[model samples]
Target: MNLSPLQAISPVDGRYRNTTQDLAQYFSEYGLIKYRVFVEIEYFIALCDINLPGLTAFDKANYNKLREVYLNFGETDAQEIKDTEKVTNHDVKAVEYFIKKKFDDLGFPDFKEFIHFGLTSQDINNTAIPYTFKLALNEVYYPKISSLIEKLKELATAWKDVPLLAHTHGQPASPTKLGKEFLVFAERLEIQLNSLKTIPNNAKFGGATGNFNAHHIAYPATNWVDFSNNFVNNTLGLNRAQHTTQIEHYDQFAAQCDALKRINNIIIDLDRDIWTYISKNYFKQKIKEGEVGSSAMPHKVNPIDFENAEGNAGLANALFEFFAAKLPISRLQRDLTDSTVLRNVGVPMAHTVISISSTLKGLNKILLNEEVITADLENNWAVVAEAIQTILRREAYPNPYEALKDLTRTNQKITADTMAVFIDGLKISAALKEELKQITPYNYTGVF
Candidate 1:
């Protein structure tokens, strides 16, 4: 059968294709090929800039043309490399041959040999993958995350004064402002985002065994170690791992994955809270016409967007955990395990993007049920026990905790009138009584 969304195996590429389409520029097969070409071209330029003995003879004016190989790279260029890969049976080698073919086409036959120079597949893979991630983070991930945070901030400010009955252990406890609840998420996300920023986009760039053996042997007089460091760090905008085996250490990469997982976990927490609030009628969704919330029951507007966000966040976290745990480990020096695993780096991120989109949708559809929130707060006059007990203690009342506990724990429903009557019978002064009477759930939200 022809390729269809239903026919695809992974939902990232299938069911949520539109939500994750931007990931294709960073994590797809073509993206990998393009990055490999980018690394190769950049490395060649770095070599030229180093003023290597043989490279000094090349025409510096053609540098723009040289960069065009990658800058203007397209599907046809990718197909050409794939064709070459069929002959070479090695992906990185195909990139080398494709660059050489480009040089030959441009009549720079002497420069062809320097295309790949002394590099291994992991050298290209490590640099290319991290470079892709750095660009994607700057261009895609950060923007999306920033947008989500901004949306959260907008909601927080919009609902700042709105009082919400706080729930602790699934029971109404105290009162908190709705905006403050959203600010909690905004704060958590900002902290994680700062942590994410601290994680360096590192890459390995030494020779086959990360020893620079070929570079050393080829030009013993040249400081190839320093050269590799400068090329990886200065030219490519990645931190250079000085010591390694055949591949990158992946410790930093793992840290990044864990960071993303933590951020997603925070979003998951927010999703669950929002879902609970929706269930409690603290939030009512803006229902669309002809949309059925439940098939059997006509009166239903489910929190499916938050549910979808939660489910996708869980999937993203699972994959991110695997990446964090598995990528950093390999049989001494090198292994092929990381190669296949690295291909799916975008999968978790794609799911994260989907979750973010779903969450934004959920936030937009929510219509805060202010009447229900106010009614709940007004009815739960028992929440004021904490304040009353504190005031009682201030007046040197004996066993204030026991007094409030006895008054609140019974089967009687606590209301504003009942609390006022109880306060009127207290042994405290009339001034204290009046002060206590002024405390209502609506105005009892401790701080802004």
Candidate 2:
């Protein structure tokens, strides 16, 4: 049985492989191994730069060669590390062995022992994962989100003056410009995205028990705390958690997940609203030839893109919820719960990527049915009752609300003509009557 899309379990890696291929460089097993290699090599270089007593004998000229082991790491290197893991029975230990093998190959065997000195698996895992996430956010996720935002902005500007009948409690109540409604989503996404930017890509770097217990024991004279902080903050470009158990506190990571969830939630809201608009005939989809909308009905052009986006967004939010709620709660010192869960960090992000792609597709398919929108507003003349009554009140017309209510209610099909005729018969002055008559559903929209 050869590997195929059908053979894979998760849809993100399987059915939707093309949609999420970019994430593989940051979240795949190969990506993880490569990141581990990067961290190990960087740690070794940092130690050498610190000019530790025992490590001072290494050749400075060979530093570039040592860095190349990871800089040019490939599938063969990753597979070699996996093979080493089989013997060591520890992932990080395997990385250390792999680096030692590289050093031996490069004729710097004496410097091999310092490859991963005084570091726990979490130290490697924490830094590598967050670094991968940070790069992925900058390289992949942020671009997709920004593209979606730009698409929404374009639609907002394009449809700024296109009137849409507003629905309140499932009934037509007023009218609003279609573009302004899109701007609402753009505003929501921008705020949440800014918050995500503020969340520091934090990582854990202390030794076994969140304190550099072993490092401090090995070199009592060195300021291990300052060293750890600098290595994590300056070298890796991540925020260092000064105090912790064996793992990162994940508070900031949880903050990031929650923020992503909120953004996905907003997309879900947009999906549902757009789906409703499609259903109400305010929008029609530009169909692709040979695409099936339904198995049974031939006269169907369903909003599957929005539906697909909604479903994927829901799945992403569920995983994000678990990540936010569960990752931050571990037993007293440390636990293995977060380890397994953290590996799937890319799952929610993959789903989010899928949803964003689907949403973009949906946005492209939509062709605004302006005629239907205007017709809906023109037919719902009773909506302007509020506007007319307010003006009547301003003119000191007694019983204005009661009069409009009587005229609108029990009149199942109110039209612009009916409202105009009724306004002309009002006892108010001709000027007030003309003002009331001028108020149509189209112009009754509060503000564009």
Candidate 3:
């Protein structure tokens, strides 16, 4: 059968392809191959810049021509590399050969040997993977997360004055501003996202076994370490791991995984809260004309968007947890386990994109059911008992805590009139009684 979205085995490419397709440029097979080619070409160009032996005679004008090998890279170029991979049984080796072929075609055949010279497969894989991951976050993931945060801020600002009956351990506890609640999530997400940005995109580039074994043996007098540092750091804009085995240590990458998992966890928390709000009629979803919430139910507008976001964020977090725990450890110097696992880095990323988009969609659809929110505040007048008790404590009222607890902690419903009657019965000044009676769920919401 022909390849299509429907034929994809993973939902990232299948069920939610449209939501995640933007990531294909960074995480797809073609994307990796293209980056590998780019790294090889740039490494060769870097060698030429250093006037490394025979490369000194190479024409500087052909640098752009060399860059075009990857700048103009397409599916056909990737397929050519894949076909070469089938013949060589090595992915990075195929990339090297492909670049050599490009050199021959571009009339720089004599200098072709310098492409990916003295490098192990991990060198290309590590550098190319991190570079692509960095670009993906900067170009795609960060923007999506920022959009969600901005949406939360916008909602928070809009609802800043609206009072909500805050729940503690599934019971009404105090009144809080609706906007303040939204701002809490916005602040949490922004802080985590800032932390995530601080982790450097690191890559291992010191040839086989990370000692420049081949490059150093070929030129014993040259400082390969400094050369690699300049190439990886300056040319590629990535941090080079100073010490390593066959592959990168993945410590920073693991930290990134943990950070992303934290962000997804926050999204999950927001999803559950909004879902609960919908359930309690504090918010209503803006329904389309013909949309059906459930097949069996005729009158239902379920919080499916939040549910979708929660489910996808959970899946992303699970993969992120595994990556954080697994990628940082390998048997001794190297192992094949991380190689296959690294390929799926895009899976969790794609899911995260889906979740963020779903969350934005859910946020857009929500309409504040102000009447219900107001009614809830009115019905939960017992929440004002805390304010009254605190004020009474300031006034040095005898047994104020016990008094409010006795009045609130009972089967008897606490109402405005009940609070007023209790306040009138208090053995305090008439002015103090008026101050206590003024406390209500509506205006008793604490400051942000």
- Candidate 3 segments whose C-alpha is farther than 4 A from its true place: none
Per-model root-mean-square deviation over C-alphas: 1.3, 1.4, 0.8
Pick the TM-score winner.
Answer: 3
Candidate 3 TM-score versus the reference: 0.99
On the 0 to 100 scale, the lDDT of residue 214 in model 3 is: 98
lDDT of every predicted structure (CA atoms): 0.91, 0.90, 0.93
Candidate 3 per-residue lDDT, tens place, 28-141, comes to 999999999999989999999999998999989988888888999999999999999999999999999998988788888888888888999999999999999999999999
Tens-digit lDDT string for candidate 1 (171-290): 888899999999999999999999999999999998889998888888889998888888889889999998999999999999999999999999999999999999899999998999
| Per-residue lDDT of model 2, residues 100-163, tens digit only | 8888988888778788899999999999999999998999999999999999999999999887
Model 1, which residues run further than 4 Å from truth? 1-6
Against the true structure, what is each candidate's TM-score? 0.98, 0.97, 0.99
Cα deviation of 414 in candidate 1 (Å)? 1.3
Report the number of backbone clashes for model 3. 0
lDDT of 1: 0.91
Q: Which model is ahead, 2 or 3, in terms of TM-score?
A: 3
Top candidate by lDDT: 3
